[model samples]
Target chain A: MSALFEFCLRMGDNTLVLGHRVSEWCGHAPVLEEDIALANTALDLIGQTQMWLGLAADVEGQGRSADDLAFLRDAWDFRNLLLVEQPNGDFGVTMMRQFLFDAWHLGQLETLIDSADDRVSAIAQKAIKEVTYHFDRSSGLVIGLGDGSDESHARMQTALDLLWPFAGEGFEADATDLELAGAGIAPNPAGLRAAFDARVEQVLQRATLSLPESRFAHRGGRTGARHSEHLGHMLATMQVLQRSYPGATW
Target chain B: MTPIAQVWEWLDAVPDPEIPVISVTDLGIVRDVDWEDGTLIVTVTPTYSGCPATSVIAMDIETALRDHGVDRIAIRQQLAPPWTTDWLKPAARDKLKTYGIAPPQPAGGPESCPHCGSANVERISQFGSTPCKAQWRCRDCLEPFDYFKCI
Candidate 1:
């Protein structure tokens, strides 16, 4: 596969997986407001996935649509970060995951707005606006819950610790990333680390949450070498309708 | 040939699927209208990326034009110059207020309850029933309302 296609998949799959995970909270969130917010966030991410994967299909010249790319692909073919595919353990865990991802996602999109490729830049331009709101909401909730009470604080801290290792994979660059970065089509994921760290540190401090001091990065999800077992189960449910019917449409 | 101006008038009559009080054109989503090689091209932008009404709005536009006997119609989605609440027409804002949905404000939240016209409104949630709205409640009237959130 071409590096551009691979890059687009990485971008698309992250949103698709995370969007699905967030959507799982639609009726189950702790409160009505939270339920609506989570659902809205999920919708924005899924919409972005359509754009990125649509571009990926166009670049591949394979006649595959975005829906086909999303539903037909198995876990092994996905290029999302392990952090996004991780289970939404609890409300706190989900928010922590979202906050971490949004931090990096915001920075990445900001840089992407200046991408050498117009399509990539255009997608970023559109996505950044929605992502800015996502980051605002997620980070605000992180601070609110983390500083609220003893129980909330403890859960937020635990979530941060549990999800931190997976966060590093977002910054790890591979050959596809290198080629895109070299061509000015995209930023090297590694270069986004500093901004990510600064944002995380600032938010965690305000949230009264401690950042886990582990730099032990998880590898493989973005590379498609391996994924967490959670991914397969998630995909099974996500792709079930399409997989069963082959070409179902509303 | 139907004048492009006539096409705009027809589109202006098509109500937004989500906010029926305002037409898609009133929402400023109908970016441009022109004729290209005998095909009527209507360019639109979505209020929010995940807005479920985008496809519906396009269909509504097409159906409205087709009813006017303009068969060669093409609806194109544009992303550049992303849609903002600022694009909402002044008349649309008045209509939204009359419909009990607060129009967007540059202050990032509703300035007053659309129903009570009281400045005692508080945000209930940053999100609402639709992607483009937020839930708010009037402190004086104790009635909850949807506010078109600024992007």
Candidate 2:
């Protein structure tokens, strides 16, 4: 119920669900190197999710372990944004999703490093290097495809358009964010939006891809608890082991 | 021998989960295998921070240590001094090649095909089965192979 734990869940759950989604590409990625990278990046973020959520569970004293929080929770209980829950349609679509998230994540982490909440700040600082490289690799692909042949360019463009609406949730400030913002312990997503936009725009320009002029932006990804069908499938895979063999340890 | 020396000898045989021929010791990641105070402390540097194999690595190390009747084991991860390709033993390189996945090489700004020993290899995609490798293809051989991605 405390603001600190809630904020940590907001952060941790996002990575947890997204990492679960990415890890599905293991042994299935179009190429060997990509499979490794996707799975590894997924590993990195999922590891962080475990830490922050465990810390959150400890602080909350809710009798819930990190594993419980991760696997036992239902779709409505998950706090990840809808964008992360979207299915990996294709290589281009997955790259676009990653690029969009990376841009916003980079901005948030850049500010999070200065957060008064030192644990989150330290984690953010340590994670920055990894995310930066992830962004670079994703961005390179974005540009490469965006500027490539007509089919490739058009497909990436379509992916860009489809994923744009989900980007809005990363910038929305809720009561929890406002509370932590007051403590200088939470990142100001709204503040980071301008920078995120600038960085993403620059990359999009280099890619020579045009953003569709859609005035419509989707909201309620966090609070509404509505999600794509993809999330239920993801949770099914991720939650099975924990649910089946309760309290199983390493 | 002291417990430290004993632990090292015991650990020298633990094979990597993915790369079976290369022992953790041969990877230069098993920094210190010793008894500190009452517990066995095994220090390790990850080949890369998010190595999916790390959990397995830790599990393997713990199992190996405990199987030798050494309990109270703690695996401390050290990431401050980064890992490089140079840490892999020369024998491991040959082992990797024999296994069909080439060993890591310096980036040299571009990747080379591990199968045909040509510089004409190009990246096919960035996501591979694991984080430590990249999917590359040999233009000459037209064979897809894993490039031990540089950290």
lDDT of candidate 2 vs native?
Answer: 0.78
> Candidates' DockQ values?
0.82, 0.27
Which ranges in model 1 have alpha carbons more than 4 Å from their true place?
Answer: none
Q: What is the C-alpha lDDT of each candidate?
A: 0.92, 0.78
> On residues A1-250, what C-alpha lDDT tens digit does candidate 1 reach at each position?
9999999999999999999999999899999999999999999999999999999999999899999999999899999999999999999999999999999899999999999999999889999999999999999999999999999999999999899999999899888888999999999989999989999899889998888877998889999998989999999999999999988888
Please provide TM-scores, in order, for all candidate models, with all chains considered together: 0.98, 0.78
Model 1, residue pairs in steric clash: none
Model 2 alpha-carbon miss at residue A241, Å: 6.1
In model 2, which runs have C-alpha deviations exceeding 4 angstroms?
A23-45, A61-63, A89-92, A111-122, A125-130, A178-186, A213-216, A223-250, B1-6, B26-37, B43-50, B76-120, B138-145
In candidate 1, clashing pairs total 0
Query: Evaluated on chain B only, what is the TM-score of candidate 1?
Result: 0.97
Q: Tell me the lDDT of model 1 at A179.
A: 92
